[model samples]
Target: PRRIVAGRIESGSLIAGDEIVIMPAGKIAKIKTVESWPVTPVAGRQGAGRSVGITLDRELFIERGDIIAHASAAPRETRRLRARIFWLHDKPLAKGDQLLVRCGPKESRATVVAIEKAVDPGELSSTENKAIGRNHVGEIDISLSNPIATDPYTENPRTGRLVIEVSGRIAGGGLVLSVDAGQRAVPVDIVPVESALRLDERSARYRHNGAVVWLTGLPASGKSTLAKALERRLFTNGGSPILLDGDTLRAGLNSDLGFSAADRSENIRRLAEVATHLARNGHIAIVAAVSPAREDRATARRIADTAFREIHVATPAGVCEERDPKGHYKKARAGALASFTGIGNDYEAPQAAELVIDTSTRTVAEAADEIEQMLKTSGVLFDEVVDLAANI
Candidate 1:
């Protein structure tokens, strides 16, 4: 069904045949027609400040909360925002407060991540505070559950102003200062189109449930070796398996990331997302990476949920350095590689891993056998019983 987007054009103009982009979702379409309150002889275009209704060339999943703009000049899509706000509620505004952030027609559930500073506008003074008092101004960081399309206040006032709602009532208003660069939009940030195939159908056909097998450890700790062996074992057993090695990902999907804490976290987040996507489609995702931080691994677990299986490759650092298949340990010791796990850096081992393997003493086949058995025990891998049932 065709939808007529009704709104006042804060700036620019919309003409028939003009390509427009729907924000947040990034759906693009052409303007098919424009309607005005006072019917004009020519209703092909509507200029700024005029309220009108415009229909697109084709139907899209547009909502009341979506912004329509010129495709070429679309705003940034981000979940993290920095803003200066005036708290109007009697209750103080505190960090971690849950609120609804509304900018024009778009609104999203948000959390006050930080209270950067509280200001007493009347006294022209400011101080660091955990909360902002009633009628006071504050600079804060807001994290949204979903990304919004917005521009900086200085750049476009129309899309930069926001209001906070607490308990369905307006509690504060703000102007967006900037968007966190690290939390900016990625190519996969658009709304997802669901697949038609059902998970149970895939499971019934494959005769097994999909899962993400995450192998995390230090460099040369035999993560890749064990991952390869496990992949071969799963494939030989008639299971659909895909291996996602860290080095290979770095050379492609994660090439933009580095060894910094933030980069590492982003790298793991992307890997987890990709692995989860694969697992959701009934494929075993075998991931081997030196995901150092427990927090990052936890995030991955949250992403993969019940499909996640964390396996800590507990190979000793001495043995890892000795093997140093890639000479990373020597480089780290020579100060050539900084923050190298098991050397210059620290690795937080999983406190509650599903399994722990010390490759220093175990053969590749042995490690793979243990993993396969674990999968069987967890019901992720189907056994001969399922095979016989399928044959029947």
Candidate 2:
């Protein structure tokens, strides 16, 4: 039997016949063969993101949750680990709650054994609580059911971080602080490897790279209207952009969701991921959603990771209620709706949005123009000649 390779090898090289060490078990074995199925066997070495099944010279004892590395430099094993985590789910996390943590091929049954403190990531202030709510940060201690290989996040982020999976979905992400003293000896950072494709290759074909323009505000704040108009503008200018409106997405991508806090956070989180994918593929993603929570918006920005701009649609609820384009606010006020933001729930106005446009004062055309100008100034629309010259 062979073991599946998780992430691609980033450092060093794995060759056939090389002595290998499996983590947590500390078992040493010889690599009999490395097979890349449905194709030729791996000749000598493999890179990241490629799938490979490794057949050990002999089965001493091994299974999943084992880290494969060269024998000379094996990963350390530890049961107790500290981490800083961002909570993304609506449910509150309390001590003694059992969960699953996964990083690459390593997964373990983990329990929240201690709650050190809760933090508001936006304000960088600590809050006292026995539990951490959705969209907050928790500095906590976790105990794994069994020892797993790990390095301090400061040392190598690939093996140092884990995703907290509640149920089957990703509920949060954690950054390992340390295995012993819980002290960061070096700066904790994930270094990105630049794409091999030249910038001109993408821009010449699509006119731009993936850029996200996020519009946040109350429901019926004319976000969709502006998004449509902006989509038209970009398309006419020989660009490709897609509009991801909240209501439209709800009817399809988010049909199971409701107006609950957790659902709301999940709604934004899913949209952010979709938008990020679209943007990375050389498409413009214009998102018009009532991402009411500040924390949710922050999560979107953090996930997008490139050319993302937040435009605050400051249309007040009173005006939106009067328009009642969808009759949502009206139903909400009549007690027909629960967990309605700007009514039962709250909409946090962005304090430092890139641009603020009030639909009551400005028409959709004007807002669209402002958004386009903002993109131009932010260099999302790069000059083709300059791009090719720099990359080539």
Q: Model 2 TM-score?
A: 0.54
Question: Per-residue lDDT for 103-186 in model 1, tens only?
Answer: 887776677899999999889898999999999999999987656888889988988899998877999999999988734343
* Candidate lDDT values, in order: 0.84, 0.77
Candidate 1 similarity to native, TM-score: 0.58
Q: Which numbered prediction scores highest in lDDT against the true structure?
A: 1
Clashes (candidate 2): 1
lDDT of model 2 at position 309: 85
lDDT, candidate 2, at 108? 63
Alpha-carbon TM-score of each model against the true structure:
0.58, 0.54
Tens-place lDDT digits, model 2, residues 241-290? 99999888999999987765456766887899899877877788999998
